[model samples]
Target: MTFSHDGLRDSLTMLAAPPYFYENLRRELATAERNRSRFTLIRFQLFPRDEQASLASEESQYELAILSFAEVLKTSVRAEDLCARLGRFEFTVILKAPSAVAESLTSRVVTSWSSHQEWSKTALCKSAIVTAKIGESSLEILNRLDNQELIGITQS
Candidate 1:
């Protein structure tokens, strides 16, 4: 896959950009179709803690929380897995692994991130995991996944 420098990576987190994420998702879908393989997509949303009103006013702190969470994601998944920043407080991972493995990793990541003393107090993460179907487009899968309630770190 070609990686264009422009919009290839998020400037704040240095993770894959939205365009890159979508492209990779499409490619992974095709690869799964061809090889009859399975892959899982994990979506993450980070929100400031309800009691942490100051976090919203402090831009630097908010950015640092995002950056730190991104680092945790980068370190948690395999190098071949695609990790992308979908929005200001959203991220995704394309894991070329079975649903079980994906689920385990998701739990592990949430645990690790929540236990971090620095940013955990300011923000909390909610995540959802969906495995790709045989005959589905990237958008279709994403839409379905989006409808599901993202499980919070404590809930996971």
Candidate 2:
């Protein structure tokens, strides 16, 4: 019944960092390959659009927004969904759903942030939702999402 420190750490939460995200993503892709099911990859970028706030304050504000947003995401999605903090201003969610469902979820998230007072201060939030393609590598999907060239729901 004993567990190592790493085991305890691994058991903590579904949310993951870049390294773990990449590893888990690889496994998830493999599972999708075997099951012949698709998953949606959604990326969220939260930032403050106000120029009045100093860079330091803006960063701190964004940090708070990120935390709040992460909580919302964790609560909103199903337990099987994977969430990750990809960077300081970026987050990725892996959902076992179609792109339409992912789009609906993305829209809901953006709308929820608008009404949430804490997220109001961090005005600019954007989300891109795309379905995982068959025979596509995890890196390719992540790289595509990272491009930010894809149009997504954005609220100021």
- How big is the positional error of residue 145 in model 2, measured in Å on the Cα after superposition? 1.3
- State each model's CA lDDT, in order: 0.86, 0.71
lDDT of 2 by residue, 3-72 (tens): 1123212222335667777877888889888889999999987655677864246455655666677777
> Which candidate wins on lDDT?
1
Mark the 10 consecutive residues where model 1 has the least summed lDDT: 1-10
The TM-score of candidate 2 is 0.80
Q: Mind sharing the TM-score for model 1?
A: 0.91
Best by TM-score: 1
Q: Candidate 2 — which residues are off by over 4 angstroms?
A: 1-14, 52-56, 148-156
Worst 10 residues of 2 by lDDT: 1-10
Q: Residues 1-156, candidate 1: write the lDDT tens digits.
A: 122335789877889998888899999999999999899999988887866475457788888888899999999999899999887788899999988998899988888897887788788888999999997999899998899789886732
Candidate 1 stretches greater than 4 Å from native: 1-5, 51-56
